[model samples]
Target: MNIFSRRARLGNAWAVNVRLRIAQGKIATIASAAEPQAGDVVVDTLLPALANLHSHSFQRAMAGMTEYRAQDRESFWTWRTLMYRFLDHLSPDHIAAIAALTFMEMQKAGYAAVGEFHYVHHQPGGQAYDNPAELSLQIIQAAALTGIGLTHLPVLYTYGGLQAQPLAGGQLRFGNSVDAFCDIVSLSEKAMAALPADTCIGIAPHSLRATSESDLRQALDLHAGMPVHMHIAEQTKEVEEVAAMRGARPVEWVLGQCEVNEQWCLIHATHMTESETAALAKSGAVAGLCPITEANLGDGIFNGASYVAHGGTFGIGSDS
Candidate 1:
């Protein structure tokens, strides 16, 4: 396939009357100072599509429902309580429908791919479905339907809090032993075989507060070199809880414990200190920022200026 654009942004500059050749679902070649051909798809403006690096597709169904204030002092925790209640009623069919719509909207908005940070795994009562990857297959099917490149992240959520508390309420659906999570990843890999080659699987260790050091290590070891994503310092309460239990802030502790690099993406690293920001900038890991969701949840602003000044890499996500 060939595409001729009157104005197209190629790298850092714009070219007039450029032609791009698509071969095997990828751009094979680009030619500038070209004329319109007889059989070419023409467009006025063309730019590279983006990848939404973090998202929870199931939450897209509860979009406008959570905007109402249920309390005088509304916060992320309070909004989370309502989200838990809302998710209890979603079946696998509902998950597929919601995910399909979310992926379609992402494509319409110029996103060619998404990294779904999926966590809702089991039935509402904490019981496993006949297949461990039931919900995961739904996400895979949705991505297939929308033709979106998917990096499905099966999150390992073991506990409820930083101190290894038992799972409760909606957290029950997300809870899984390290062994069970491995099974889910294995089954999900099998299900993704029907999708395009670019559709792949990754692992997420929900967050510092939700997993122990031992559990996190086990989850990391499950996927040898795949993309690793984790929720870091998103909320102040979470930061305090992790610091109290682990004796260091979330970013500082993870940096000390892990060999973070380009393959890792730390989501919502919104509450970092000067040293933590500098260290993360130098670590070669992508800072996954979800500005819209961060603002909605009242999560603090990321240190973008300072991080960029230090030559950091970052990506944007919807995260809903």
Candidate 2:
């Protein structure tokens, strides 16, 4: 028996005689019936770890080195070109090695789980790999190796924008049709099922620009009932184009068209109208924010104060 009584929680007060019974790597029982013995270890406090709701684990390596300049008006678009150059060189093994290093740091920082928004699927030339989901599996392997929870959200990138343009050279690996994306998602799900119950697969449509209405509907139907994620309103040019093409803003368009519920995470809803902001806050979906990356990319300040006041739920990410 162990006496573990305290009016406070999680570093608020000390714990005494908090003997733990472990069953299959889980706590089976906590006995607080008696005092601590002489050799008993004393713990100050304990709490369940938090989750990083979004990440591109491989890009963690590129965090601080992207601020160089070549000419005037160096914007996010110019920075993206540099990112393409960075991504062009990574193979599955290289990505796995990088991810393992990053995840170890995340564990030490107290993030027990990471939701990876993955998109690099094929080779640089957009050719199918021997293992279509090879890169994704590598990330999963890294997460397992580092002892952090993984929610693998594979991204679906189709066209470049509302113009239905072809993907540029840097975007080849992220390109996927509705059929190909479904196949990869299925394969990822089967692989994720082999992990602990806490590890699972989620779906991601890269953004409104990347997928047509038909493609979006197809993916939604295919991955129905799964946690879904998407990038939205991260840049003003994107907002302008989306508004011009669809006559509705990105977040507004998505909320009007699809089911925006708790199972969805709208990444980077940085630009919003008052109505859109209020609606999103009430929508029960997680608003994925990357404040550090946002500042680096000049993505503008998100309405954090208003969103919180409206009862919005959000989680941090390292979007790279």
TM-score of 1: 0.93
Q: What is residue 95's positional error in candidate 1, in angstroms?
A: 0.5
Per-candidate Cα RMSD to the true structure, in Å, reads 2.1, 3.2
lDDT of 2: 0.85
lDDT of each: 0.93, 0.85
Candidate 1 structure quality by residue, lDDT tens digits, 1-320? 99999999989999999999999977899999999898999999998899999999999998988776777889898888989999999999999999999999999999999999999999998999999889999999999999999999999999988779999999999999999999999999899988877788999999998888998898887688989999999999989988888899999999999989999999999999999999999999999999998998889999999999998999999998
- lDDT: worst 10-residue window of model 1: 64-73
Candidate 2 lDDT, 105-139, residue by residue in tens = 88899998999999889887888889888888898
Off by over 4 Å in 1: 6-17, 22-29, 39-45
Top-scoring candidate (TM-score): 1
- Separately for all candidates shown, the number of backbone clashes (residues 3 or more apart, or on different chains) is 0, 2
